[model samples]
Target: MTQLPLLEQAILVLAALTLLASFSMLAQSRLTSAIHSFAWQGVMVAAATALVAAVGHAHHLYLSALLTFSLKGLLIPWMLHRLVRRLNMEREVENIAHPALVVLAGALLVILAYWIALPIERLELASTRNIIAISLAIVLLGLWLMIARRQVVTQVLGFMSMENGLFLAAVASTRGMPLVVELGIAFDVLVAAVLFGVFFFHIHESIESLDTGKLTRLTEEEPA
Candidate 1:
Protein backbone atom coordinates (compact mmCIF):
# COMPACT_ATOMS: atom_id res chain seq x y z
CA MET A 1 0.00 0.00 0.00
CA THR A 2 2.79 2.41 0.87
CA GLN A 3 4.46 1.74 -2.48
CA LEU A 4 1.44 2.96 -4.51
CA PRO A 5 0.86 6.61 -5.38
CA LEU A 6 -1.49 8.69 -3.20
CA LEU A 7 -4.09 9.11 -5.96
CA GLU A 8 -4.26 5.35 -6.50
CA GLN A 9 -4.77 4.84 -2.78
CA ALA A 10 -7.63 7.32 -2.76
CA ILE A 11 -9.29 5.52 -5.69
CA LEU A 12 -8.90 2.21 -3.92
CA VAL A 13 -10.69 3.59 -0.89
CA LEU A 14 -13.56 4.86 -3.00
CA ALA A 15 -13.76 1.56 -4.85
CA ALA A 16 -13.90 -0.31 -1.56
CA LEU A 17 -16.67 1.96 -0.32
CA THR A 18 -18.55 1.34 -3.55
CA LEU A 19 -18.35 -2.39 -2.87
CA LEU A 20 -19.57 -1.89 0.68
CA ALA A 21 -22.52 0.10 -0.62
CA SER A 22 -23.44 -2.88 -2.81
CA PHE A 23 -23.56 -5.10 0.28
CA SER A 24 -25.56 -2.50 2.12
CA MET A 25 -28.11 -2.55 -0.64
CA LEU A 26 -28.23 -6.31 -0.57
CA ALA A 27 -29.03 -6.22 3.13
CA GLN A 28 -31.43 -3.26 3.22
CA SER A 29 -35.17 -3.94 3.38
CA ARG A 30 -36.88 -0.58 2.88
CA LEU A 31 -37.23 0.58 -0.71
CA THR A 32 -36.19 4.16 0.02
CA SER A 33 -33.05 3.15 1.87
CA ALA A 34 -32.02 0.86 -0.95
CA ILE A 35 -32.40 3.71 -3.42
CA HIS A 36 -30.32 5.94 -1.18
CA SER A 37 -27.56 3.32 -1.02
CA PHE A 38 -27.67 2.97 -4.78
CA ALA A 39 -27.24 6.71 -5.16
CA TRP A 40 -24.28 6.67 -2.79
CA GLN A 41 -22.75 3.86 -4.85
CA GLY A 42 -23.13 6.03 -7.94
CA VAL A 43 -21.36 8.92 -6.25
CA MET A 44 -18.52 6.66 -5.18
CA VAL A 45 -18.21 5.29 -8.68
CA ALA A 46 -18.04 8.82 -10.14
CA ALA A 47 -15.43 9.87 -7.61
CA ALA A 48 -13.41 6.74 -8.33
CA THR A 49 -13.58 7.34 -12.07
CA ALA A 50 -12.46 10.93 -11.64
CA LEU A 51 -9.55 9.75 -9.50
CA VAL A 52 -8.67 7.15 -12.11
CA ALA A 53 -8.51 9.94 -14.69
CA ALA A 54 -6.19 11.86 -12.44
CA VAL A 55 -3.93 8.85 -11.92
CA GLY A 56 -3.96 7.63 -15.55
CA HIS A 57 -3.89 11.09 -17.15
CA ALA A 58 -6.94 10.21 -19.23
CA HIS A 59 -8.74 13.53 -19.61
CA HIS A 60 -11.65 11.97 -21.49
CA LEU A 61 -12.51 9.97 -18.43
CA TYR A 62 -13.43 13.26 -16.78
CA LEU A 63 -16.39 13.57 -19.13
CA SER A 64 -17.52 10.06 -18.23
CA ALA A 65 -17.18 10.85 -14.56
CA LEU A 66 -19.42 13.88 -14.92
CA LEU A 67 -21.97 11.90 -16.89
CA THR A 68 -21.99 9.13 -14.32
CA PHE A 69 -22.38 11.58 -11.44
CA SER A 70 -25.22 13.42 -13.12
CA LEU A 71 -27.04 10.41 -14.49
CA LYS A 72 -26.42 7.65 -11.97
CA GLY A 73 -25.79 9.76 -8.90
CA LEU A 74 -28.40 12.46 -9.35
CA LEU A 75 -30.99 12.01 -12.06
CA ILE A 76 -31.67 8.30 -11.80
CA PRO A 77 -31.91 8.35 -8.02
CA TRP A 78 -34.30 11.27 -8.11
CA MET A 79 -36.41 9.45 -10.64
CA LEU A 80 -36.60 6.40 -8.40
CA HIS A 81 -37.58 8.51 -5.44
CA ARG A 82 -40.41 10.04 -7.41
CA LEU A 83 -41.59 6.64 -8.57
CA VAL A 84 -41.59 5.43 -4.99
CA ARG A 85 -43.60 8.42 -3.90
CA ARG A 86 -46.08 8.03 -6.70
CA LEU A 87 -46.56 4.35 -6.05
CA ASN A 88 -46.63 4.93 -2.29
CA MET A 89 -44.12 2.12 -2.05
CA GLU A 90 -41.32 4.04 -0.43
CA ARG A 91 -41.84 2.34 2.91
CA GLU A 92 -42.28 -1.13 1.49
CA VAL A 93 -39.95 -3.74 2.97
CA GLU A 94 -38.26 -6.32 0.82
CA ASN A 95 -39.10 -9.99 1.50
CA ILE A 96 -35.98 -12.07 1.90
CA ALA A 97 -36.49 -15.67 2.96
CA HIS A 98 -33.11 -15.75 4.62
CA PRO A 99 -31.20 -12.53 5.18
CA ALA A 100 -28.23 -14.17 6.90
CA LEU A 101 -27.84 -16.72 4.18
CA VAL A 102 -28.13 -14.03 1.51
CA VAL A 103 -25.29 -12.09 3.13
CA LEU A 104 -23.20 -15.24 3.37
CA ALA A 105 -23.80 -15.97 -0.30
CA GLY A 106 -22.68 -12.46 -1.19
CA ALA A 107 -19.42 -12.99 0.69
CA LEU A 108 -18.85 -16.25 -1.11
CA LEU A 109 -19.41 -14.43 -4.41
CA VAL A 110 -16.60 -12.02 -3.54
CA ILE A 111 -14.23 -14.91 -2.96
CA LEU A 112 -15.29 -16.52 -6.24
CA ALA A 113 -14.83 -13.27 -8.14
CA TYR A 114 -11.29 -12.95 -6.80
CA TRP A 115 -10.51 -16.46 -7.98
CA ILE A 116 -11.99 -15.83 -11.44
CA ALA A 117 -10.26 -12.50 -11.92
CA LEU A 118 -6.88 -13.77 -10.75
CA PRO A 119 -5.55 -14.61 -14.18
CA ILE A 120 -6.81 -11.38 -15.70
CA GLU A 121 -5.36 -9.43 -12.81
CA ARG A 122 -1.99 -11.10 -13.38
CA LEU A 123 -1.99 -9.97 -17.02
CA GLU A 124 -3.01 -6.38 -16.27
CA LEU A 125 -0.56 -3.71 -15.15
CA ALA A 126 -3.14 -1.11 -14.07
CA SER A 127 -3.66 -0.23 -10.41
CA THR A 128 -7.35 -1.08 -10.93
CA ARG A 129 -6.52 -4.76 -11.32
CA ASN A 130 -6.78 -5.21 -7.57
CA ILE A 131 -10.39 -4.02 -7.62
CA ILE A 132 -11.61 -5.97 -10.62
CA ALA A 133 -12.66 -8.83 -8.39
CA ILE A 134 -14.68 -6.46 -6.21
CA SER A 135 -16.51 -5.08 -9.23
CA LEU A 136 -17.44 -8.56 -10.42
CA ALA A 137 -18.62 -9.45 -6.93
CA ILE A 138 -20.90 -6.43 -6.91
CA VAL A 139 -22.40 -7.55 -10.22
CA LEU A 140 -23.13 -11.03 -8.94
CA LEU A 141 -24.60 -9.66 -5.73
CA GLY A 142 -26.99 -7.48 -7.73
CA LEU A 143 -28.13 -10.48 -9.72
CA TRP A 144 -28.63 -12.42 -6.53
CA LEU A 145 -30.63 -9.57 -5.04
CA MET A 146 -32.98 -9.63 -8.02
CA ILE A 147 -33.58 -13.34 -7.61
CA ALA A 148 -34.13 -13.12 -3.86
CA ARG A 149 -36.61 -10.26 -3.89
CA ARG A 150 -40.26 -10.47 -4.98
CA GLN A 151 -40.94 -6.75 -5.42
CA VAL A 152 -40.59 -5.05 -8.78
CA VAL A 153 -38.92 -1.95 -7.37
CA THR A 154 -36.30 -4.01 -5.59
CA GLN A 155 -35.68 -5.94 -8.77
CA VAL A 156 -35.20 -2.65 -10.60
CA LEU A 157 -32.70 -1.56 -7.99
CA GLY A 158 -30.80 -4.78 -8.54
CA PHE A 159 -30.77 -4.17 -12.28
CA MET A 160 -29.39 -0.68 -11.82
CA SER A 161 -26.76 -1.90 -9.39
CA MET A 162 -25.64 -4.52 -11.85
CA GLU A 163 -25.15 -1.81 -14.44
CA ASN A 164 -23.25 0.21 -11.86
CA GLY A 165 -20.90 -2.72 -11.41
CA LEU A 166 -20.36 -2.92 -15.13
CA PHE A 167 -19.51 0.76 -15.32
CA LEU A 168 -17.10 0.45 -12.39
CA ALA A 169 -15.39 -2.49 -14.09
CA ALA A 170 -14.97 -0.52 -17.30
CA VAL A 171 -13.57 2.50 -15.49
CA ALA A 172 -11.18 0.38 -13.45
CA SER A 173 -9.88 -1.75 -16.29
CA THR A 174 -9.85 0.74 -19.16
CA ARG A 175 -10.25 4.18 -17.59
CA GLY A 176 -13.78 4.16 -19.13
CA MET A 177 -14.98 3.61 -22.65
CA PRO A 178 -15.25 6.17 -25.44
CA LEU A 179 -17.31 9.25 -24.65
CA VAL A 180 -19.90 8.23 -27.23
CA VAL A 181 -20.38 4.79 -25.70
CA GLU A 182 -20.71 6.15 -22.18
CA LEU A 183 -23.22 8.71 -23.37
CA GLY A 184 -25.31 6.00 -25.01
CA ILE A 185 -25.30 3.90 -21.88
CA ALA A 186 -26.27 6.89 -19.76
CA PHE A 187 -29.22 7.63 -22.04
CA ASP A 188 -30.28 4.01 -22.05
CA VAL A 189 -30.36 3.89 -18.24
CA LEU A 190 -32.50 7.01 -18.13
CA VAL A 191 -34.89 5.53 -20.64
CA ALA A 192 -35.10 2.28 -18.76
CA ALA A 193 -35.99 4.12 -15.56
CA VAL A 194 -38.78 5.91 -17.39
CA LEU A 195 -40.06 2.66 -18.81
CA PHE A 196 -39.96 1.06 -15.40
CA GLY A 197 -42.08 3.86 -14.03
CA VAL A 198 -44.68 3.19 -16.70
CA PHE A 199 -44.63 -0.52 -16.00
CA PHE A 200 -45.13 0.12 -12.29
CA PHE A 201 -48.33 2.04 -12.98
CA HIS A 202 -49.67 -0.69 -15.23
CA ILE A 203 -48.75 -3.40 -12.78
CA HIS A 204 -50.46 -1.59 -9.94
CA GLU A 205 -53.60 -1.00 -11.96
CA SER A 206 -53.88 -4.64 -12.93
CA ILE A 207 -52.98 -6.29 -9.62
CA GLU A 208 -53.06 -3.52 -6.98
CA SER A 209 -49.55 -4.49 -5.93
CA LEU A 210 -45.99 -4.47 -7.18
CA ASP A 211 -45.21 -7.96 -5.98
CA THR A 212 -44.05 -9.89 -9.01
CA GLY A 213 -45.05 -13.13 -7.32
CA LYS A 214 -48.67 -12.06 -7.64
CA LEU A 215 -48.32 -12.25 -11.40
CA THR A 216 -48.11 -16.01 -11.18
CA ARG A 217 -51.72 -16.14 -9.94
CA LEU A 218 -52.92 -14.64 -13.18
CA THR A 219 -51.81 -17.74 -15.11
CA GLU A 220 -53.66 -20.29 -12.99
CA GLU A 221 -56.49 -22.25 -14.58
CA GLU A 222 -60.06 -21.64 -13.48
CA PRO A 223 -62.79 -24.32 -12.90
CA ALA A 224 -65.14 -24.71 -15.89
Candidate 2:
Protein backbone atom coordinates (compact mmCIF):
# COMPACT_ATOMS: atom_id res chain seq x y z
CA MET A 1 0.00 0.00 0.00
CA THR A 2 1.26 3.46 -0.81
CA GLN A 3 1.90 5.55 2.27
CA LEU A 4 0.46 9.00 2.92
CA PRO A 5 2.81 11.80 1.97
CA LEU A 6 4.86 13.61 4.62
CA LEU A 7 2.52 16.59 4.56
CA GLU A 8 -0.50 14.36 4.95
CA GLN A 9 1.10 12.48 7.83
CA ALA A 10 2.00 15.73 9.56
CA ILE A 11 -1.57 17.01 9.22
CA LEU A 12 -3.04 13.82 10.58
CA VAL A 13 -0.58 13.71 13.47
CA LEU A 14 -1.31 17.28 14.47
CA ALA A 15 -5.03 16.63 14.27
CA ALA A 16 -4.55 13.66 16.58
CA LEU A 17 -2.57 15.83 18.98
CA THR A 18 -5.35 18.38 19.06
CA LEU A 19 -7.92 15.69 19.81
CA LEU A 20 -5.71 14.23 22.55
CA ALA A 21 -5.27 17.60 24.21
CA SER A 22 -9.03 18.09 24.17
CA PHE A 23 -9.49 14.75 25.89
CA SER A 24 -6.84 15.71 28.41
CA MET A 25 -8.74 18.89 29.05
CA LEU A 26 -11.74 16.77 29.96
CA ALA A 27 -9.66 15.09 32.67
CA GLN A 28 -7.55 18.01 33.83
CA SER A 29 -8.39 19.19 37.33
CA ARG A 30 -6.82 22.62 37.14
CA LEU A 31 -8.05 25.51 35.05
CA THR A 32 -4.56 26.81 34.26
CA SER A 33 -3.44 23.48 32.89
CA ALA A 34 -6.52 23.10 30.72
CA ILE A 35 -5.91 26.56 29.32
CA HIS A 36 -2.29 25.68 28.56
CA SER A 37 -3.29 22.46 26.84
CA PHE A 38 -5.84 24.30 24.74
CA ALA A 39 -3.20 26.79 23.68
CA TRP A 40 -0.79 24.04 22.70
CA GLN A 41 -3.51 22.34 20.70
CA GLY A 42 -4.20 25.54 18.85
CA VAL A 43 -0.52 25.91 18.01
CA MET A 44 -0.39 22.34 16.79
CA VAL A 45 -3.36 22.90 14.47
CA ALA A 46 -1.83 26.09 13.14
CA ALA A 47 1.47 24.36 12.45
CA ALA A 48 -0.32 21.54 10.66
CA THR A 49 -2.27 23.97 8.50
CA ALA A 50 0.93 25.79 7.61
CA LEU A 51 2.58 22.51 6.70
CA VAL A 52 -0.31 21.54 4.43
CA ALA A 53 -0.34 24.95 2.80
CA ALA A 54 3.34 24.74 2.10
CA VAL A 55 3.14 21.26 0.65
CA GLY A 56 0.00 21.73 -1.45
CA HIS A 57 0.65 25.34 -2.41
CA ALA A 58 -2.68 26.57 -1.10
CA HIS A 59 -2.05 30.28 -0.66
CA HIS A 60 -5.21 30.97 1.29
CA LEU A 61 -4.33 28.32 3.84
CA TYR A 62 -1.54 30.55 5.03
CA LEU A 63 -4.20 32.97 6.18
CA SER A 64 -6.02 30.14 7.88
CA ALA A 65 -2.82 29.24 9.68
CA LEU A 66 -2.31 32.83 10.70
CA LEU A 67 -5.89 33.01 11.97
CA THR A 68 -5.41 29.87 14.03
CA PHE A 69 -2.11 31.08 15.46
CA SER A 70 -3.29 34.56 16.29
CA LEU A 71 -6.84 33.91 17.42
CA LYS A 72 -6.93 30.40 18.90
CA GLY A 73 -3.30 30.11 19.97
CA LEU A 74 -2.57 33.55 21.39
CA LEU A 75 -5.62 35.76 21.73
CA ILE A 76 -8.23 33.38 23.01
CA PRO A 77 -5.95 31.69 25.53
CA TRP A 78 -4.65 34.96 26.88
CA MET A 79 -8.15 36.30 27.16
CA LEU A 80 -9.29 33.17 28.99
CA HIS A 81 -6.37 33.38 31.44
CA ARG A 82 -7.14 36.99 32.17
CA LEU A 83 -10.84 36.30 32.41
CA VAL A 84 -10.27 33.56 34.94
CA ARG A 85 -7.99 35.77 37.00
CA ARG A 86 -10.29 38.72 36.88
CA LEU A 87 -13.29 36.63 37.87
CA ASN A 88 -11.28 34.91 40.64
CA MET A 89 -11.87 31.51 39.07
CA GLU A 90 -8.24 30.54 39.03
CA ARG A 91 -8.82 27.45 41.13
CA GLU A 92 -9.73 23.83 40.51
CA VAL A 93 -11.38 22.64 37.31
CA GLU A 94 -14.16 20.45 38.57
CA ASN A 95 -15.91 17.73 36.59
CA ILE A 96 -19.53 16.95 37.31
CA ALA A 97 -18.74 13.36 36.36
CA HIS A 98 -15.85 11.23 37.57
CA PRO A 99 -12.52 11.83 35.86
CA ALA A 100 -12.36 8.17 34.92
CA LEU A 101 -15.79 8.37 33.31
CA VAL A 102 -14.85 11.49 31.43
CA VAL A 103 -11.78 9.79 30.05
CA LEU A 104 -13.84 6.77 29.08
CA ALA A 105 -16.36 8.95 27.26
CA GLY A 106 -13.59 10.59 25.27
CA ALA A 107 -12.17 7.22 24.32
CA LEU A 108 -15.56 6.05 23.15
CA LEU A 109 -15.91 9.13 21.01
CA VAL A 110 -12.61 8.43 19.27
CA ILE A 111 -13.54 4.79 18.75
CA LEU A 112 -16.89 5.73 17.31
CA ALA A 113 -15.30 8.20 14.93
CA TYR A 114 -12.84 5.64 13.61
CA TRP A 115 -15.51 3.00 13.29
CA ILE A 116 -17.77 5.28 11.30
CA ALA A 117 -14.88 6.29 9.04
CA LEU A 118 -14.18 2.72 8.02
CA PRO A 119 -17.02 2.64 5.49
CA ILE A 120 -15.59 5.50 3.42
CA GLU A 121 -12.15 4.10 2.73
CA ARG A 122 -12.34 4.18 -1.04
CA LEU A 123 -11.57 7.87 -1.60
CA GLU A 124 -7.91 8.66 -2.28
CA LEU A 125 -7.61 11.74 -0.17
CA ALA A 126 -5.16 12.76 2.51
CA SER A 127 -6.61 11.35 5.71
CA THR A 128 -10.10 12.23 4.54
CA ARG A 129 -12.19 9.73 6.43
CA ASN A 130 -10.00 9.60 9.53
CA ILE A 131 -9.82 13.35 9.88
CA ILE A 132 -13.54 13.80 9.40
CA ALA A 133 -14.27 11.16 12.00
CA ILE A 134 -11.81 12.68 14.43
CA SER A 135 -13.32 16.08 13.83
CA LEU A 136 -16.80 14.78 14.57
CA ALA A 137 -15.48 13.17 17.73
CA ILE A 138 -13.99 16.43 18.76
CA VAL A 139 -17.32 18.17 18.28
CA LEU A 140 -19.22 15.54 20.23
CA LEU A 141 -16.67 15.51 23.05
CA GLY A 142 -16.87 19.26 23.26
CA LEU A 143 -20.62 18.99 23.61
CA TRP A 144 -20.05 16.39 26.29
CA LEU A 145 -17.76 18.73 28.13
CA MET A 146 -20.45 21.38 28.12
CA ILE A 147 -23.04 18.97 29.44
CA ALA A 148 -20.78 17.45 32.09
CA ARG A 149 -19.59 20.66 33.63
CA ARG A 150 -21.19 23.34 35.76
CA GLN A 151 -18.63 26.04 35.24
CA VAL A 152 -19.31 28.69 32.61
CA VAL A 153 -15.66 28.83 31.65
CA THR A 154 -15.57 25.11 30.95
CA GLN A 155 -18.64 25.41 28.81
CA VAL A 156 -16.96 28.19 26.91
CA LEU A 157 -14.00 25.90 26.39
CA GLY A 158 -16.38 23.29 25.07
CA PHE A 159 -17.73 25.74 22.52
CA MET A 160 -14.20 26.51 21.42
CA SER A 161 -13.51 22.83 21.03
CA MET A 162 -16.51 22.52 18.76
CA GLU A 163 -15.15 25.31 16.62
CA ASN A 164 -11.80 23.57 16.48
CA GLY A 165 -13.46 20.40 15.28
CA LEU A 166 -15.30 22.26 12.56
CA PHE A 167 -12.04 23.79 11.38
CA LEU A 168 -10.35 20.41 11.39
CA ALA A 169 -13.12 18.90 9.31
CA ALA A 170 -12.84 21.72 6.80
CA VAL A 171 -9.13 21.10 6.50
CA ALA A 172 -9.57 17.38 6.03
CA SER A 173 -12.29 17.73 3.40
CA THR A 174 -10.83 20.60 1.40
CA ARG A 175 -7.26 21.11 2.60
CA GLY A 176 -8.36 24.59 3.68
CA MET A 177 -11.29 26.93 3.53
CA PRO A 178 -11.26 30.37 1.95
CA LEU A 179 -9.49 33.19 3.73
CA VAL A 180 -12.60 35.36 3.89
CA VAL A 181 -14.65 32.60 5.44
CA GLU A 182 -11.96 31.88 8.01
CA LEU A 183 -11.72 35.56 8.81
CA GLY A 184 -15.46 35.80 9.27
CA ILE A 185 -15.44 32.85 11.62
CA ALA A 186 -12.63 34.39 13.60
CA PHE A 187 -14.53 37.62 13.95
CA ASP A 188 -17.64 35.90 15.19
CA VAL A 189 -15.67 33.90 17.70
CA LEU A 190 -13.92 36.96 19.05
CA VAL A 191 -17.15 38.81 19.52
CA ALA A 192 -18.76 35.86 21.23
CA ALA A 193 -15.81 35.44 23.57
CA VAL A 194 -15.81 39.08 24.59
CA LEU A 195 -19.52 39.00 25.24
CA PHE A 196 -19.13 35.84 27.29
CA GLY A 197 -16.28 37.38 29.26
CA VAL A 198 -18.47 40.26 30.28
CA PHE A 199 -21.26 37.87 31.14
CA PHE A 200 -18.82 35.84 33.24
CA PHE A 201 -17.93 38.85 35.32
CA HIS A 202 -21.59 39.65 35.84
CA ILE A 203 -22.35 36.10 36.86
CA HIS A 204 -19.44 36.07 39.27
CA GLU A 205 -20.43 39.37 40.78
CA SER A 206 -24.04 38.28 41.33
CA ILE A 207 -23.37 34.77 42.62
CA GLU A 208 -19.66 34.68 43.47
CA SER A 209 -19.26 31.58 41.31
CA LEU A 210 -19.15 30.69 37.62
CA ASP A 211 -21.47 27.73 37.76
CA THR A 212 -24.38 27.36 35.34
CA GLY A 213 -26.63 25.90 38.05
CA LYS A 214 -26.52 29.22 39.83
CA LEU A 215 -27.64 30.96 36.67
CA THR A 216 -30.46 28.49 36.32
CA ARG A 217 -31.48 29.23 39.87
CA LEU A 218 -31.53 32.91 39.09
CA THR A 219 -33.81 32.23 36.18
CA GLU A 220 -36.07 30.04 38.28
CA GLU A 221 -36.39 32.62 41.02
CA GLU A 222 -37.25 35.48 38.71
CA PRO A 223 -40.94 36.41 38.54
CA ALA A 224 -42.55 35.31 35.30
Kindly report which residue stretches of model 2 are placed more than 4 angstroms away from their true locations once superposed.
Answer: 218-224
All models, RMSD in angstroms: 2.4, 3.1
lDDT of 2 at 28: 78
**lDDT by residue for model 1 (17-80), tens:** 9989989988998889999999999999999999999888999999999999998899999999
Candidate 1: residue pairs that collide: none
Every candidate's lDDT: 0.89, 0.82
Residue pairs in collision within model 2: none
Worst 10-residue stretch by lDDT in candidate 2? Answer: 120-129
Candidate 1 lDDT trough over 10 residues, lowest sum: 215-224
Scored against the true structure, residue 93 in model 1 reaches a CA lDDT of 86
Q: Tell me the TM-score of each prediction against the true structure.
A: 0.94, 0.91
